[model samples]
Target: MSTDGRSASDSTTASALESASFVRLVTKADGDGLAASGLVARALAARGTPFQVTVGRTVATRTERAQATTGGDGDLTLVVGSTDATNATRLDTDDRPATLAAVDHVRDLGETPDLVLALAGLVAAGVEPGAGESEWLIETARERGLVERRPGVAIPTADPVDGLAHSTRVSAPWSGDVDATHETLSDAIGADLEAETDRADDADASGTTLEHTDHRALGSVVALDAVSAEAATAAAAESIQRVLKPYATPDAPFETVGGYADVLEATAQTEPGTGAALAMGHDAREPALAVWREYGRRAHNALEAASTGRYDGLFVVGIDDGPVEAVAALSTAFRSPEPLVLAVGAGEAALATREGTLPPLEGVARDLESVLEGTGDATDQGVTYDVTASGRRGYLQYDPAVDETTIIETVREYQ
Candidate 1:
């Protein structure tokens, strides 16, 4: 084994997949998981390997493990990006299959262990990248126009109106309020906001979209709004402008990879099956986009109505009913100095922190698991815990039996 937990060399190849009668691919329901699993499924198909994709929380349960192995002999189960899984062909750092051992090497080189890197490893293993192929997933995505390297605002869509209205990043007070959105846009862009919208509409009608200059102009106004917001910190506002790699394509469901990730994440918030279908490259784009838009509205509205209490190192926002993941993610656009803990009644809560925060959330979540009588795992710089004691077995779900006050106190203690 090499430093950073990867084997120094790999001998695994497509032969492992080719010999299998069937392949079951399993991964988390989040964006990276979906993208990685989908790419793997595509590669498996290209190799004539029959495969089915399954998505779940970060950790695979005992039942999931059992089902993963239920296929007849000669069938293979491939698990990707799960924290703790067994009885399968593990492609993550834990078991360090040669197929993905390079993931650690890439990590050691300071790159993310994302879908593209996963594909790069697979490509090295003689797996074809499907028709119209390239050796690397990034190259393939670029060749197919699945992603463009143009830098722009982090908003997934080009339309300033829709971007502002549905954006979780800017955390504009007008979120989910169309009139408020229009008013804010008018304030930032002057009467030009209406003219720009009309022009964009005309462009859409003419099969020509707005220019990059127009996007940058609108993005500038958004940057100003974020910097000027009282709730925003300098660091957070800086992060907003820093995320310039706007990944999008007209052929894809959402405007950008960020956008697609948003929609997939929101869909997974309540409907894992729907999220998994979209993630596995199934033709579920329209319904998934619809789910994201609706989820955005509810989550933003919840953020607006939340009863916020600021602590030394945490901000507790209590909401009635909304997607906990959405609430946590959207609220981060404002860039609070402290991590945000959002609670839904006493039955559900999530802790969301900006990436690279202190007291790494995995440790924090493990600590809270004991106190909350719950099981939790770190996903996207934060943790989602379900209070198993309450008999709930879903993401962001805790037990009302734990009570609201105790949850708050426990979080406070851990924070």
Candidate 2:
């Protein structure tokens, strides 16, 4: 149950979905959103219910579109990937990941157990599988085909070459460099690459069945190399454990469920339309894969090129190119004990805490507004802001004259 004492069971959501003449699944374009949409689609299909799925940027936009289409009639609308809902049923699991709740929704609707969907939800959720509800979910997925009981080194694919080449957790020199990745893997694990690739190829040729033992052992070795390739901070160890066990489905485009989620996230960051299509079960793999690979390459380059400086309890990074949002997260994942402040271009900055222990940005924004006399944009994790002599439209407006260092120091003072 949630801390609010709300039941996690999908009985109510299932009943609502079953009785509605038509359903609309509104989700974000991210990995979790896509996974949630797919799960809902499956459940509705099993129930023989008609539904339409759409992707949006925020809860308001998603529900607004749903309402516009449904005309505020009898159609039921469900919001996924976010806790906030308006005139719709929210399918998020304790604000963790919507996919978990979606999995339960499918079963509640009497759909048969789907191993791939369950495994994907677990991977996307990125929570410990030993926990109460997660434990039950993982056990069911394992009974069907899940290989590992817990998360290991998160190299998304069974093929070490492909996985390492696309890994952003590790820095350059090996990331996006297939030869370097291969050499690193060969030196670290000393495995027979030819034989292993042959086996993986055979598995792909015959079917999508994963070689459980081989994947487990190989994933460990690759994970070790990934840690060594980057600074071996405590955050590196924590990030290493973020990888879910690799599982595959013949119906999906990627080899492992981890790979599927990875690519989806990458595509979401780069080519959102393709990402949404792939999430909604559209046939756009080739273009999506291209975008995912390029996104990985650019993200690695950005991380490598970022200039890092230290404050008392903050590590600030400045990125001149590439995806600032994604790099901010990557920097946080590899951060030290100090919180990370990402300086995006010259106008705005974002702050992130290790493991997201930072309190809501609302209070911070309020304090900053009083002190700096500027506007601030707050999110659950961090804030986007710039100090203006006079607040523009009561919102923080970027002033290029105000340097990033000033913003970082102001944010730190409030923290």
Best candidate according to lDDT: 2
In candidate 2, what are the lDDT values of residues 56-143, reduced to their tens digit? 6443455566556644465788877442345678766434566666666676677754555445545544544445456666566556
Candidate 1 has which clashing residue pairs, if any? Answer: 247-257
Write down the RMSD of all candidates, one decimal each: 8.4, 7.0
lDDT of each: 0.53, 0.57
Per-residue alpha-carbon lDDT of candidate 1 for residues 49-104, written as tens digits (9 for 90 to 100): 68887766545342265354686887877665544444676554433323344343
* Local lDDT at 158 for model 1: 49
Candidate 2 stretches greater than 4 Å from native: 1-12, 59-72, 83-85, 146-153, 169-173, 186-221, 244-253, 282-285, 335-352, 362-414
TM-score of each: 0.71, 0.74
Which whole-number lDDT from 0 to 100 does residue 200 have in model 2? 49
Clashes per candidate (backbone, < 3 Å): 1, 1
Candidate 2: lDDT over CA atoms?
A: 0.57
